[model samples]
Target: MDGLLLQGFFRSSAAWRVRIALNLKGIGYAQVARHLRRGEQRAPDFMAKNPQGLVPALEVPGQGVLTQSLAIIEWLEETQPGAPLLPADPWARARVRSLAQIIACDIHPIQNLRVLAYLKRELGQEGPTVDAFARHWITGGLAALEQRLATEAETGLFCHGDAPGLADLCLVPQLGNARRFGTELSPYPTILRIEAACLALPAFQQSAPDRQPDAE
Candidate 1:
C-alpha cells in the first residue's frame, strides 16, 4: 500500500495525536505541513482536501480524505492492528475510550486553534486573556482526570494499564498543550507520572512536536 498523506501543523495537539498513533502503529506516511499560524490551512488547495479547513486531515491512498484526530486514530487502529491502542476486553476498551473522550471531545475542542482564534478575533480578546481561558479549562479537566486516575485501580504505569494505550496518547498531547500555556500541572501528580512513563517510550518521544520535521 502507498503511504498515507498527512496534512497537518506540527504544533497542533490534534495533529500530534495522529502522529503518535501512526508511529505507535509503525505506519509509514508522508507529512505535508500546513502551518496554522501562516493561514495555510485556509488556502484554496487545503480547502479542496478538507472543506472544514482543519489541520490533521489524512489523505489515504485510495480511500479518500479522513478528518478529525479521533477518527483518524481509530482508522489507524482498525487498519494497522500491530500495536493495539485499545484493550482486548470489551469493558476495558470502554474504560479507555471514556477516558480518551473526556480529553478529546470535552476538553480539546473548547481550546483548539479555531476556538482560540475566534476568541481573539471575534471577541476582541487579547493573547493573555485567551491563554488564561485555555488554561482554566485545561486545569479543570485535568483535575477531574487526576481524580479518576489517582483513585481508580486500573491506573498503572500509564493511564490504563502498564502499557501505553489510547488514554496515554490523549493524555500526552493535552499535557503538552497545558504546559505550552503554562498551566500548573504539578497539581496532578498522577498525570505527571504517567506522562513521564509515556515519554520513556520511543514512539511517544520521537513523535513529539519538537521532533517533527516541520517543527520550528
Candidate 2:
C-alpha cells in the first residue's frame, strides 16, 4: 500500500467531507494538522502542496497531491471503485451531484471560515450579526433542500437512495455547521431525517469535526 496523507483542519466542513469519503473507502491515511485559525494554511510549506491554502489537501504516494474536497472525493471514487460514492445510473448520479452542490456550492462557501472572517474583519460585523448571517443563508439553503427532498421521489433513506452516497457526504457537514451557528433545524424534517441516517453510520460519525485529533 502506498502512503497517503490528508492535510486539513479539524473544524472545516470541507475537510470533513473528504474525511468521510476516505473512511467510506476504507483507506488508511495519516493526518497532518493545518490550523486554519492561525493562518497556517497560508504558510509557504502548506501552500506549496495546495496553492489555494485550503484544508483537506490529499497527498497520495504515486499521485502526488490532490486539492478541493469534491474533486478529491471524485478521484477516490475513480481510483477506488469498490466502495462507490456515486450512483450507477447517469441520471441518478446527476441528481446526487445536484443535491451535493446545493450544500457545497450554495451553502458551505458563503458560511466558511474565510468568508466569516472577512465578514468580521473587513466588513466589521459583530458576533450576533455574523451569526445571523450564517443562520439566514443556512436556513435558506436547507429550506430549498427540504422542499426538494420532501417532494422528490429520489430521496430515500439517504439523499438519493437507501445507500449513502455523495450527497449524504455533503449534507451531513453542512448540518453540523447549521447546528454550530444556532440555525433552527426543526423546519426541515426531511433534511433532519437524512442527517440522522448519515450520522448513524460510523463513516460519518468518525469523520466529524469533534472526532478529529486536532479538534479544539
Candidate 3:
C-alpha cells in the first residue's frame, strides 16, 4: 500500500487501464513517467524492473514488481476489494472477462507500441501505412464489440449491467486510441454511448492521458 510506483507512459492504453483500476479502487500511487517514444523502457533501470521492456510495470513496496495490465488489475482487485472490478458471481465474472479480453487480448496487442515500431523500423512501412493498418484492425474489433453491446441485454450504463467494471475500463482507453487515429466511432453508437457514460465518472476522467503529469 505504501510507495506504490507506477512505471508507465501517458498515452499507453495498457497503462491507462491500470490507472483507471487504481483510481476506481481509490489506491494512491506515485507515477514515474516512461517515455515510450524515446525508447526509455529499454533503459537499464526499467529493464531491471521489467525485462520485457514494457510500460506499466508496477512496483509495490513489499511485493516486488508486477507486469501485464490484466494481471495487475486482478491483483489490485484481490488486494483492495473495496470497489470490486469484476462481478461477484462466477458466470457474470466470466462474461466480464470475455468482454474485457475482446479489447485487451484481440485489439490492443495488435496495435501496441512495439508492434507499430516494428512495422516502421523492420518492415520499412511508412507512418501512414502503419497507422492505416492499426485503424483497420481497431475498427473491425470495435464494430464487433458495438454489435454485441447493442444486442446484449446485460449491457446497460456500462459494458456490464450498469456498473463501471473491467470491460468498461478496457473499452474507454481503446476508444481513446481509436479517436486519436481518427477512426470514426459514429458507427459504434453503443460503444460511444457506453464511453460517454464511463467518462461521466471521476475515475475514468482523472485517468485520461490528457490529465496525466507527463501529458503534452
Residue 78, candidate 1: alpha-carbon lDDT: 76
Q: Order candidates by lDDT, high to low.
A: 3, 2, 1
Per residue, candidate 2 scores C-alpha lDDT tens digits across 1-216 of: 358899998988889999999888888888999998899999999989988898889999876899999999999998784568999899989989998999999999998888889999999999999989998889999999999999999889988889888999999989889989999899999989989998899989999998899998
| lDDT tens readout by residue for model 1, 1-216 | 467988988898888888888888877788999999899999999999999998899999768999998888888887775689988899999999999998998888898878999999999999999999999889889999999999999999999988888889999999989988899888999999999999998899988989988999
> How many clashes show up in model 1?
0
TM-score of 3: 0.97
Candidate 2: TM-score? 0.97
lDDT by residue for model 3 over 1-216, one digit each (tens)?
Answer: 768899999999999999999999889999999999999999999999999999899999988999999999999988885688998999989988998998999999998878988999999999999989889889989988988899988888998888799999999999988877788888999999999999999999999999999998
Displacement of residue 143 (Cα, Å) in model 3 is: 1.1
lDDT of each: 0.90, 0.90, 0.92
In candidate 2, stretches whose alpha carbon ends up further than 4 angstroms from where it belongs are: none
**Candidate 2: how many backbone clashes?**
0
Residue 11 displacement in candidate 2 (angstroms): 0.7
| Structural similarity to truth (TM-score) of each candidate | 0.96, 0.97, 0.97
Q: Please, what's the RMSD in Å of model 1?
A: 1.2
